[model samples]
Target: MPQTNGNAPGRCAPIPKTIPPMKDLTTENITENVIALNNLCSDPRTRYLFERLVHHLHDFARETQLTSEEWMSGINFLTAVGQISDDLRAEMILLSDTMGLSLLMDAIAHPRVPKATEGTVLGPFHTHDAPVTDNGYVLHDDPGAEQLFVLCNIKDTEEQPLENVQCDVWEGDSHGFYDVQKGADRQGPDGRAVLRSNSEGVFYFTAVVPVPYPIPDDGPVGGMLKLLNRHPNRPGHIHFMLETPGYDKLVTALYPRGDPYETSDPVFGVKESLIVDLSLVDEAVADKYGVKVGMKLLTYDFVLASDEQAAELRKDRRKEAAAKLDVDISTLHLD
Candidate 1:
């Protein structure tokens, strides 16, 4: 029934109309809504990143028809990962490493600098303020490990030795446990040390022959791996961080020639050029290098890129990134 207010003759108050059901939710509408909000961002990079992230995430969910339980389980898993992360162990990095994202990022950031050693992941094990030592210093005296001498030669693209280069080297013990993973009662450091290259760009050190070992997987990441039916093992390798003025800093690893897990390294840290075949040297030859008899010796050379070359490489990378995003190169230009 209609009621009249009598303000005007034959005037009646109109009945309120029913609101139509919200426009049927659809995949296209949902994606558009998420992307539209991205325009609110002031920074172009942030805006682009968010827009892509939202689109992909929404698409994944829509394509998978993700269930509520599955979404909640993922949230719980991430929360657990965060809960267990701390100073010594970073669960997020572990997750990324095991998933090979770390290596992918490294490849993107460092696009195989010409004549320079290809880089690898700087695993979660590196610590700052490492004890600095002179050439030919041994970091570990583990009786169980086979003594192996490392002779490193650092040079530029022109094959000339570079001076004042700091060669930081570290590895795990014979049992494949780093110093940080061992009990407090463990004595001395297990495969961690630093030395600087001499005027001839040569440095020497005695370290254990690195053994293939499983990454620390007792935590949430390990649990996730178990669920994914994947093994958490890295190949026998030694980490090297070479740094010097007027050159690109190199973070690389030297893999033993015959490591069983070389092809399946959990972190994907292996590089073909970085693999070395250790040679067994006789006492006479060993004495010349100050290494014990019946031990092995590994000789390797590292090449570094100049600052100008690195700058040019970066420009190319930016262009590639822009192409990948299907955006104008100027959009990524820095203010």
Candidate 2:
């Protein structure tokens, strides 16, 4: 007979007398038994989440007829995900991303805000240590990178310029590698900066056109992608995080029009609205942005939604995230 007392080795507290003892669990009864005990979870939301999680997880095992070896393999895969994660690399986020869960959550959390910019995945490469620089900042120096000039103008939904906005920018080099990927944690920052928009609600930066690259795959998430026969390529793009008073912070990226990988970005970060056009600018235009002549000029304009509107839109999902997602939202790229 199974022990019902909390005193049993490695067991939880004794069941309350009001509830009957659990019978031996079978395949059909196991899910229900787990849920029954999970009802004791004090947080109403956590209880509901556990109920659903148990149902779907058990159902998956049953429907797939998952074997013991396969189950052990899954366990080992998760172990590797935990083992490889650190401050520099987040394997869990990568796993959620590879499985399309991150993008799905992004879609749910961030809905369209009239004419405002759309949000996308905050890929695993963003860093907080990017230095604040002047408007016409040079962010990279890769010999192989094609010269590019970037201009961003920020406005509110009503089309009025919003000055003093902080724009955090980052991108990969011609070879498709971020400074962090190049071991910058030891070498210090490159290819990223925090810029302030001027009176015209504009910020300028000199960069190399981003190129497609495989996400850091040498880990458990990569192995899972291989098993699923999926490609891990993301399209060439520039990431932007815009924040200013009384407006919702926008986390978004702009994909250049011609990347072949745009159609199949493994993380599903691409949307038609996020695609951008580039122009080869004259010397005068290049000088305005403080870069040398012949560099391609890419201009992207962004509109931000007010805080009031974003709060209303995000209330539903915020409740779930507040219910102990086991993550510090600040630490995760999705924030």
Candidate 3:
């Protein structure tokens, strides 16, 4: 009888010629396997989505030759992101914003319309319960910061003024700190407030020139940026959310012409139409808006989409968003 090599000390048998190699996989078969596994999902949409997601994810891993260690690192990073989330902060939104997914989704859901203000990412700092005040309220009363006058005209496509619309505005202070980022000792809402557009659809506020600032980078997303050799800075801009009956809610930001990072906003929130110039105001012009002479002023007119138009544009988005929010699509309005 022939003795196998395993009988020898520290030796193993040679592989049998009859043993077959591991099964070879083709692209079609790889994707087909995932589809077969998920085709039984209870929900048709879920099944379709999971199948496609699995196919693409698998293809990406194979194409990149992803190592097990790298995969583990990604999982660890995501775990960290979830671990650090809280009511005041959402790491997932930050991640999505940094990746430009937020802006992409906004664009897809709210396609641009003629004369309507372009949409932008609702940055991590927006609060629904911003302190409501009359027009011309001061948002940045902190001494020594340059004062800026924000005068915005709210209008419809036909250029008719929109009254009773609330404009929620917020921004970072000169030192790049938002109210929430500062400690409890810091006074509330350092650079945020809500004001209503006047009868002529004009809203005005006194604020500090928002300085360029980095998104919160003390977390996993920041670590990813470091690994990618990318900066975490967003161009200075004032966030605006406009809401009213009979019109679509608008979320947008205004970028100054010379903000250092205007052209290279990390979040890709800048749009040509959203960029405006801040000019020095003469005493007469300044007195017109109630600000003292020699202050800076930014004037912009925002055209809001009518409710009917917005509903038509985001019909599918409404349903999807409603499902996620556990609300009826018919009850969802653009606010």
Give the per-residue lDDT of model 3 (tens digit) for 93-114. 9999989999998897677766
Model 1 stretches astray by more than 4 angstroms:
1-26, 183-189, 282-288, 330-335
Task: Report the number of the highest-TM-score candidate.
Answer: 2
> Every model's Cα RMSD, please?
8.8, 5.4, 10.7
- Compared with the true structure, what per-residue lDDT tens digits does model 2 show for residues 225-275? 888898889999999999988998898999999898989998889999999
Each candidate: how many clashes? Answer: 0, 0, 0
Q: How does model 3 fare in lDDT?
A: 0.82
List where candidate 2 sits over 4 angstroms from the true fold.
Answer: 1-20, 315-335
lDDT of candidate 1 at residue 258, scale 0 to 100: 86
lDDT of each: 0.81, 0.83, 0.82
C-alpha lDDT (0 to 100) for residue 220 of candidate 3: 96
Question: Of the pair 2 and 3, which is ahead by lDDT?
Answer: 2
Ranking by lDDT: 2, 3, 1
Candidate 2's TM-score: 0.86
Write the number of the candidate with greater TM-score, choosing between 1 and 3.
1
